[model samples]
Target: MTTSATTETRTAAREEAEGHLRALVGSDDAVLRDDQWSAIEALAVDARRALVVQRTGWGKSAVYFVATLLLRSHGAGPTVIVSPLLALMRNQIAAAERAGIRAVTINSTNIEQWQPINDAINAGEVDVLLVSPERLNNPGFRDEVMPRLAATCGLLVVDEAHCISDWGHDFRPDYRRIRTLLDTLPTGIPVLATTATANARVTDDVAEQLGRDVLVLRGSLDRESLRLGVVRLKTAEMRLAWLADHLAEQPGSGIVYCLTVAATQEVAAYLRDRGHEVAAYSGQTDTTERQALEQALVDGRVKALIATSALGMGFDASLGFVINLGAPQSPVAYYQQVGRAGRGTDDATVVLLPQLEDRDIWAYFASLAFPPEQLVRQTLEVLGDAPGAMSTVALETYVELSRNRLETLLKVLDVDGAVRRVQGGWVATGQPWSYDAERYARVAEARQREQDAMLAYLDSTECRMRFLREQLDDPEAVDCGRCDNCGGLTLSTTVSDAAVAEAGEALSRPGVAIEPRKLWPTALANLGLDLKGKIATGPAAGRAIARLTDLGHGQALRALFRAGAEDGPVPDPLKSALLTVMKDWSRDWDERPVAIVGVESSTRPQLVGDLATGLSRVMQIPIVGRFAIVDPSIEPGRGAANSAQRVAAVQRRYDLMADVPAGPVLLVDDLVVSGWTLTVAGVALREAGASAVLPLTLGTQT
Candidate 1:
C-alpha cells in the first residue's frame, strides 16, 4: 500500500474504532468534555505509537477500549494487549465482557487453556487478546500461535508502558522486546501504550524503546479530595494506639500496610482486638487463602486489611483509606499502594505512619544500589537472549543473583530491554548485542542516578507535590498547600523555663508531706528490683540508681519503696509522719498554691530549706521537719537527675522533707531534651513534698 493509502486506511480504521467505542459505552449522543476527549482523540489520530501518560482515575482504559472497538469495526484483524499484571487483565476482560465485546486474556493461569482464544484470533473472530510478556515469549506460543495471529493483528496495546523503561518505577525486562516482536509481525502495527505514572525521562525512554513517533498525554497529578496525614512515633505500641484512634474516627474499607508477614499478622490481631473486622494477607499465606481474603476485602465483608506489599499488584478495590504503617522501600511501591485507594474518583485518605526506625530501612535500601550497573547489564543480556521467556528459577540461576535481587533487577531491565523473559528463560532482541556497551552502561548509571534522586526527594524538606512535579520536569511547579510539609504543620519543640520553674516552686512547699528515700525501698519492693540487682550500692549500683531516678522513681531507695509500698502493709512510723505532713500541707496550700520549685544550691540542708519555704508559701501553714537532709559531698547515684552534686542535694533535701504535705510540683532543670533528669527529679519530689510533679525546662535540644 502507498503511504497515502496506508494513512487513509489507518484514519478510516481509527474512526470506526472510535465509533465502536461510543457504541460499546452506550454513549453515542454523549459529548465528553474537552479535557477528557482530547487525549482519546490524539491517540486515535497519532501515526506513531502514542503514549497516554495520564494520572490514575483519568479513564485511560477507555481510551484503548475505544481504540480496540474502532479498529475492529473497521475490519482491522485483531488487537493484542500486553498487560503487566494478570489481575488487571482479568479486570479489563470482565469490563469488555460486560460491554458485550469479545475480549480474552492468555496468561500463566490459563495459557495452557488458550487454544480457543488462539483459534479465534487466527480465524479473525477475536477483537482483543490480552497477554503477558512472559506468555508472548513462550516458545510454544511464539512458534505455534503468534505467527498465525500476527497476520491479522492491527493494533498493539502496551498497558502500564512505564514497565518498559528503565526509568519507570515498575520496569519489566520482558516489556522491552515487545517493540521487536511488533516489528517482526507481518504488518507494522500501530502501537498504543498507557501508564498512570511516568516522569519526562521515563516518557522519553518509552518513546525510544517503542521505536515510534510518540504522542504524549499529560494529566494533573493532584488528588485534591484525599487527605494526607503523617504520624511519627517512637514505638510500635504508640503506632498501634494512634492507629486505633484513627480507625475509630474514620471507619471504612482501608488498608494497613506492614513491613513483614509477622508484622501484618500482629497488626491484624491488634486491630481485631479493638473490634475491627480485620483481614491479613502476606506471601506466607496460601494463594487460595490470599485470593479469598482479597475477595472479601473487595466485597466489603472485611472493613480493613493489614497486608504486606504483596496485596496490591492484582487487586482493584476503591478503598476509603490506605495507611502505610511503615515506609516502603521505593517511591514506586509507595505510589502503587496509594493508588489503590481513590481509584473510583471518590475522596480517600492516605495515612503514612513513619516509624523512627524507618530512616535505617531507607538507608539500607539506598545502599543496595551502589553496584547495580553490572546487575543491570547482566539482566539485560539475559532478557535480550530470551526475548520474552523465563522461569523464575531459570532466571535466578542465570543471573546468579538471589530471587529477590533478580526480581528487582529484572523489573529495571524490563524497562531498558537489555533483555526480557519469555516464560522459562530470557530473550534479547531489541538493542544490538554489540550496541555500545558504553551506552548500556550509561543507561544503568542513569537509572542509579534517578533512584538516588528519588531517595533525595523523599528525604527532602520541601513540599512532596512540588518535589514530584519538579522530578517530572515541571519547572513551574507550585506549592500544593496540602501535604504536611506545605501546610507548615509540625510538633512544637519549645518548652519554657519559666513554666518548669513555676511548677517546681509550687511543689516544694513546707507543711507538705512526701515519701522519703529510706522508705522508698519498702514502697517499691514488689518491682523485683532486688532480683535484678537494680538496688545495689556499688559503682554500678549508683549508675542503676541514677537510671531509675531518671525514669522518675526518685532515688533508688525511694523507687523501691514506691514499688513495694502499694503491695504490702506498711505501718512504719516515718510513713505515718509523712502522711500527717502531707495532710497538713494540702490544707495550707489550698489557696494561692505554688506550681513549681527548684533547688538553688548543692547543699542538702539548703535544698530542704528551699523546698520547705516553697511548700510553706503555697500551703500558708508550716509543718516543720517535713524535709530530710543529705550530705552534699556524696556523688549522685547512676541514673540520678543531672549532676551528681545537684541530685544528691535534691535527694537529701527530699528525704528530709518527707513529712511535708505535697502540692503540684514542677521540677526545674537546665536541659530538658529526653526529660530523663526531670523525670527523676519529679519522682523524687513527689515522694518527698509534691503531690504531682511536672517538668520545667530552661532549654531543649532542637
Candidate 2:
C-alpha cells in the first residue's frame, strides 16, 4: 500500500476507535484526551509498554478498555488486568460488559466459579480477565494458568500500579509479583501500568520495573471538584459528632473513612443510632456483605459507608463527599481516597477530622513493615528443611512471626528469588539471598517522612490540593482555588452539644465481646504442647468493658494498659463500669455464675485480684480460689504475640488451687488477648470441679 493510502487507513482507524470510546462512555460527544490517545497508540499501534500517571477519574480505565477493544479487533488474545481490590474488579467487570467486552475476575470471594472461569478463558469466551495481585501467586493460577496467559495475553494492565513500588504510600508485597509477570511476557505484547497516587520516586521505580524504553505519560494531579478542609477536633467524641451532624448536609452519599476496623464499626453504629442510614465496610466485613454495601452506596440507599482503607480503590461511587474521621499517614493515600469523591459530580465536599491519635495509628502500621534479617533467615531455613511444601497454617507452627507479617515476608522472599510459591504452600529456593538492610531502613525512613508530610498537610495554611500535588511531585500544581485555604475555611467546626453528648455516650458505653477460642492452634504438638484439635470446652463467650481500639473508651484503656505503665488495682471508675457490665450481662445469662475465679497474673496480680474480688462482691458470688502459675520462671509474654507462642506460653503454666467452689464460675482477668490463658485456666477449673466457666475481662485486644 502507498504511504498516502496507509495514512488514510490509520486516520479512519483512529476515528472508529474514538467512536467506540464515545459509545462505551455513553456520551455522543465524548472525546479522548491527548495523553489518553498517546497511551492507546503505544499499546495498540506499537505494542509497547506505557505507564500513565494521571489523577483519579482521568479516564485511565478508558485507555485500557479502549485499547483492549482495538487489540481484540486485530485478532489479539484476551487482556489481563491485575487489580488490587475486589470492589475495583467488580466495577471493571460491569464497565467492560457495557463496552461490549466480556470481563471476569478470579478473586478470593469466588472460589466456586474459578474452574468455569478458567474454562471460559481457555475457550476464548473472555475478552478481559480482572484478577487480584495475590492471584498471581496462587498455586493453581501461578503454576498452571499464568504461564499460558502470559504467552497469549494481548495486553497486560496493572491498575493502582503504585502498589508495585515499595516507596508508594500503600505498598503491597503481592504487587511485587507483577515484575515477575512482566519478565515472562513475550517481547511484543503491550503492557500498561496506571496509578493516580504515584510520586516521582514511585513513578520511577514502577516505570523502570515496567521495562526499557517505556512511555511515561504524567498529567496534573489536581482535582477540580474537591473542596478540601480540615476539621480540628479536640477529641474522638467531637470527631464523631462532627460527622454525624454534617453527613446529611453534604452533597450526596459518600464514604466516612476510619483508620481502624473498630473505629469503622463504632462510627457506623453511631451514625445508625443518630438515625442516619449507614453501614460499616471493613476488612472484617464478609465478601457478600461488602458487595451488598458497595451496591447500597452506589444506589444511594445508604447515606454513607463507614469504612477503613478496605472501602478504597475501585469502590466506584460518583460520591458527593468523602469525610475522614482521622488523617491518613501519607498525603498520597489521602489524595487517592479523597479522589473517590466528586468523580461524577461537579463539586464534592472533602473534609478531614484530624485527631491527635492518628499519629499513633500510623506508627502502629509502620511497625508491621518487613521483619528483621534474623526472622527472614529463620523462615528460609524452616522452609528449606521442610520435607515438602507446608501450607501457611502449618508453616506457622515452625515460625514465631504473626500470620500477616509472615505471609508478607514470604511474598518478598518469593520476589527476591529466595523462596518459591508452590501448590501446597512455599519452598525455599536455596538462592543466595542477601537481606537488603539498607533498603528496608530507607523505606522505613520514607514512611516516617510521609507521616510528617501528612501532619504538614493537616496544618498547612496554604492550598490543601497544592500541598498534596507537590507531595505527589505533580509539576503543574497550583492553588486549586477550591480548598478551604485557597478560598476560605467555610466549613463550620462547631458541633451541637446534644450530638456531642450522644457521641460521648456511644463512645463511653462499651460492651465489646471477647469471643472464646473454639479450636486449638493448628500445630500445638510441634510446639511441644499436648493441645490438639477442638478446645473441648473453653471459657463461655465473654464480654469486655471495651476494646482497646474503641473510639470512646479505647483511648483511656490503651493509655492505661500501655507498656511500662505502673500496674495497680482496678480503679473506682472501672470498677463501677464493671458493675454496670455485670448488671447488663445478668439480663442475658441463662444461668448466673455462682463463683469467681481469678487468672494469676505476675505482672498485674493486684489488678486481677481486685477486679475478681470486686466482681464477686457485686454479684454475690463466692471466690473460687485463683489459678496459680505453676512456673514463675516461664513468662507468659506479651498478648500481641502470635497464637501458637501465646498458647504454648500459658498452656501448662496454670493450675487451679485445691478446694475450689463448685457450680458456674466467673473467670476474671485484667485483659483477654489471645484467650489462651482463659482457655488453659478454664480447663483447670473444669477439672477442679467447676460445672461451667464464664469469662469476664476488663478489656479485649483485637
TM-scores for every predicted model: 0.59, 0.97
The global C-alpha lDDT for each of the candidates, from Candidate 1 onward, is: 0.56, 0.86
- Which ranges of candidate 2 are over 4 A from the true structure? 1-10, 638-640
In the range 1-702, model 2's lDDT, one tens digit per residue, is 112336666676577679879878999989887888988888887788999999989999999999899888888999999999989998998998898999999988789999999999999999999989999999888989999999999999999999999999888889999998999998889999999999999999999999867999999998888999988989888888888888889988999999999888888889999999999989999888988999989989999999999889877779999999888989999999999999999999999998777876887788798998988888999998999987777777777778899888899999889998887789989899998999999999998899889999888999999999999999999998888998744899899999999999888786777787888888778788887888876777888888877887777777778878788888776777777777788787778888887888888888888887777777777885888898777776632347887777675566777465667888888887778788888877877777878888999877
lDDT of model 1, residue 655: 45
Which lDDT tens digits does candidate 1 get at residues 289-405? Answer: 876787787777888889887776536776788888777755555666777777764567777776544544454445444234565567566655653566554444344354555
Clashes of 1: 89
Best by TM-score: 2
